[model samples]
Target: MSSHSKSLGEFDLIERFFKTGANSLRTTADSAIALGIGDDCALIRPPADEEIAITSDMLVEGRHFFAGADPELLGRKALAVNLSDLAAMGAKPLGFTLAIALPMVDKIWLEAFSKGLFAASYDYSCPLIGGDTTAGPLTISITAFGSSPTGKAIRRSGAKAGDDIWVSGTVGDARLALAALRHELNLPNADLQNIAHRMHQPTPRIELGIQLRGIASAALDVSDGLLGDLRHILKQSQVDAEIQLNQLPKSITLQKQGIGIQNQFAASGGDDYELCFTAPSTQREKIHTISKILNLPLTLIGKILPKKDVEVRIHLLDASGIELSNSEAAPFLNSFDHFAS
Candidate 1:
C-alpha cells in the first residue's frame, strides 16, 4: 500500500474514492448545499427559522481505537460520534465534512471505509459536503452540521430541582467489551461478539433527541460515562442529583456480570453513546409512551435535587436508599479524560 501510495496524489485520492462516494450519498439536503466538493469550500444554507448545530469529533489510531481496527467500522464511528453530538442538542443532521490523514493510500482500506462512512451518511440523511485529505498519521476528523428549531435545542443547563433523570437504551456494554478485549476480564466469545457492536457501531439517538425537544429539560449523550457526564448538567444548572446504582439499565450480557462490575462499568463506561436526559416528573407518563413509540427503553434512574451548599454534585445510592460515601463511590466518579495520565 505504501509503495502504491507514491503514485496516488492527494487530489486523485479524493476524487476517485471520497468525492465519488460522497456524491452517491447526496440527499434532499443537497438543495441547501449551494456548493459541495470540487471547490474551495462548501456552502450550506440552514433551513429557515432553524439554528444550525455544529459538532466535530476526531479519532486517531491507537488512541481512540486499535492500530489495525476495521476501517469500515472506524469510518462509521467517525461520523456517528459527531452525529451523537447533534442528537445531544436535539438537532437533525444536515451534512458533514471529513478531514482524514492517511499513513498510506490503501485502495482496499479506502473502499471499505468509504462504504461504511457513506452508509452512515445515508442512514442519517447527512451527506458529505466537503473536506480535505492529507498525508500523516492515520486520523479521521468529522464535523457534522445539524439544525434545530430556534431556541428549542435542549441544553445541559435546563435541569430543574424536581426533574426526573432518564436514560435511553442501555449502558456498560461497550466498556465490558473493551475490558474483555484488553484481557482485563474474561467472557464467552459469543457474549463478546454480542456486545462488540456497541463499541464499534454506536447508534446515534437522533430521532429520540428530536422527539425530546420541549419534553426534556436537559440532555447529553453518555460518551464520557453516565455519572461523570451527568455532572455536567448538575454543574450547569446549579443543581444536585441522586441516582440509584441498581436502576441503571444494562444489557442482558452486561447483567451477567457481578454487581460490582455492573456498577463500575454502568456508571463510568466511556463510549456508550446513549442519551441521558432530565424531564419534569409530570412528564413520566409521556416519556414512557414515547419509549413505546420508539421501541426504545427509557429508564428512570434518578431525580434532580436542589443545590446544597456542598461540593458534591451528585450522590450514588444503593437499593436500600443509603447514599454511598465519597470513598465508596470514588471509582465511578471520574469520567474518561483524553489527556489524563
Candidate 2:
C-alpha cells in the first residue's frame, strides 16, 4: 500500500479522488440528478410519465475477474454490466451508485480506476450519485438507475409465438478470449488482443434498447451464454425457440476457430453483453433500417415457438435450418452455471 493512500481516511479519499468535477454529470439544470455526491443521500427525479428502472451487479475477484487485472478496465466493466441490464429493459440511463470494497488503499490504482469509471459515466451521460466504500476483499458493486416511458419497458414476458429472435453485435469472442487465457485453446497474440477487449470493455446497447422499445416484443442482455439468457425469455413468455447455428454472429477473431469451437462458444460462452430480442416478422424492414442507422449488425437468429406440450424448450438447428436430434444438441444445450463445479 502507498504511504499517501495509507495516510488518508475514507472520507478524505472520497473528497480528494471521487468528489471532483470530473465525476459530476449534472452540468445542466435539466439533468436527472437534483443532488449528486456530498449529500447524505443523492436525489433523483425522473421526468413525468416515466418509470424508473434499476439494476445492480457485483464483480468479485478470482471469480468474475483475475487478480492484478487492469484497474481502469475493471472500473469500466463494473458499471457497464449494470448498464447492460437497463439496456435490456429499453431504459435511458439516469445515474448510478457505486459501493466498493478494497483490501487496501492504493493511490495509483484508485486514480486509474476512477479515470476509467468517470470516462464511462461521461460517455453514457450517467452521473455518480452516492455509495459506500469499505475495507475488505476487493469487490465492486454498482446499482444503476434508468427511466422509460410508462408501459413501454420491454420485458421477457412479452415475447409471443412467431416472433423473430434477434441478437445485436457479435458473440463468442469473450469466451474465446477466456479459453485462450485458460490455455484451453491456443491463439496468436493478435487474436488474443482482439478478443480481450470484448471480454474487458463490453459496450451496452443503450441506444439500441431505446429504439427497440415499441418494436421489440421482448428483450434481454446476453450476459451468461446466449442460450442460457434466452431461456429466461422462454420461461417468462411460456414459449419455445428454434435457432440456427449458422445465424449466430461472430467476430473475425472467433471465426478463425473450427466449427465445433465456434458453435460451442457462441452457444454457451458468457460475457457477451449484446442485446437479444424478439420482434414480429412485419417489423423486419424497420429493424433493418435501425441496424443501418446505428451501423450495428442485427442478425435474425431464431423464432419463438408455441409451447405445445412442454413448459419451455429450445430447438437447436443446423446451418441448413434442420432441427438437431437430442443426441446432436446435448453438448450445446448447457450453459455456464455459477454453482456448477
Candidate 3:
C-alpha cells in the first residue's frame, strides 16, 4: 500500500465523502477522454462533415425520481432520457458523461447500477466518456452527445399549416406507472408490473429518429406528456393542430380499465417516450411503410391547421361524416396547465 492511502473508514463513508465526481468504476471511453480525471477541461473530436448535438438532464431524488428506486435502473434511465433528446434531433449516438452524488457507498447498489449503465451504454454504442462524483443527495446528472450530417438535423420549427402530424408508440405509460407505484390505482399485478417496466426502462427511438431526418418536418420526444411536448413543436413551427382523440395510441389495458377519455390520459399524461413529428400529407404512406419495415407503429393522428394558437380537436366524426365536438367528447390538451399546483 502507498503511504498516500487514506482509510476508507467504517461504512466506507470516508471514501464516498471524498469521491467528488463520477465513481472510478464508471466505464471510461479512454480514447475520446483525451484529458480525463484531474483535468481542468476535456476535449473531443466531432464526426467529419457533421454537427454535434448536445443535451443534458438532472435526475434528482424525490423530484425527478423516487428515493427508493433501484439504482441500476436509475443509471440506465438517466442516460436513456438524455439520449431521447439527441434522438429527437436525428443525431447518431456518440458518448455521455455522468455526475453522481450519493449519500454512502452501497456496493450492491453500485454494482447493480454500474451493470445497468454499462449494459445500456454498450447496447447503444454510447460510451461513458467522462464525469465527476460528489457527496450529496442522491442525484445523477447526465450529458449526452451526438452528431449528424451538417444541415440534416431535425428541429422543432419546420411544420407548415397543411402538414400532417404523427406519433410513435402510446402515451400515459409512465404517469400510469407512477400511479401504480403510488398505489393510487389498484391495477392487476401483471398490469402494474408492465407499467413499472415502462417507467424504469424507456426505450429511446434513436434509429427511427435518424430515419426520419429527411421525412419529418419537425420532431420532439413525448417526455412531458403528448400535449405539453407537442405544444413545443406547435409553438416553434408557429402552427396549430386538431389532433383526433380516437386516433391516439392508448393501451388496450388502459382502455379496458375504463380510464375515462376525458382524462386525456393519452394527451395530458406524459412520459410516453414516443416521437411526435410532422410531414407533408403526401408522405403519410411513406411514414407508415418505413414503420412497417422498422416494425415500429407510427400513427397519423391529426392535421396542422391555420390558427393563431395550438388547439386540439378530438373525436371529429358524426353519422353524416361531419365534424363533431362535445364538451365531454373532445378532451383537448392543456399541457402547460395540466397538473400545475
lDDT of each: 0.89, 0.87, 0.72
- The lDDT, on a scale of 0 to 1, for candidate 3 is 0.72
Name the regions of candidate 1 deviating beyond 4 angstroms. 1-11, 310-312, 337-341
Best by lDDT: 1
Q: 1-341, model 2: which lDDT tens digit per residue?
A: 11134333763675456767335555442277877777678889998999999999988887888889899998888889888999999999998888877888888989888888888888788888777776779989999999999999999999999999999999988889888988988999999998899988999999999999999999999998898899999999999999998899998888999999999899888999999999999999999999999999999999999997666889999987789998888667777653234
Backbone clash pairs for candidate 3 read 20-133, 21-132, 21-133, 22-132, 22-133, 225-270
Q: What is the per-residue lDDT of model 1 for residues 84-133, given as tens digits with 9 covering 90 to 100?
A: 99999999998899888888878889888988899899898998988777
User: TM-score for each prediction?
Assistant: 0.95, 0.94, 0.83
Could you tell me which residue pairs clash in candidate 2?
none
Badly placed stretches (over 4 Å) of model 3 are: 1-39, 259-263, 309-332, 336-341
Q: Put down candidate 3 lDDT per residue, 1-341, tens digits, no spaces.
A: 00112323433442242232233434333344344333444566676798989999888788777778887898788888888898898997777777777777677787777677766776677766566555568988888888889999999999888899899877777777776677877778888776677778888899889999899999999877786677788778778776666677777656655546423667777667788999999887889888998898898878877656345333343335456556544354545232333
Q: Give the lowest summed-lDDT range of ten residues in model 2.
A: 1-10
True-structure lDDT of candidate 1: 0.89
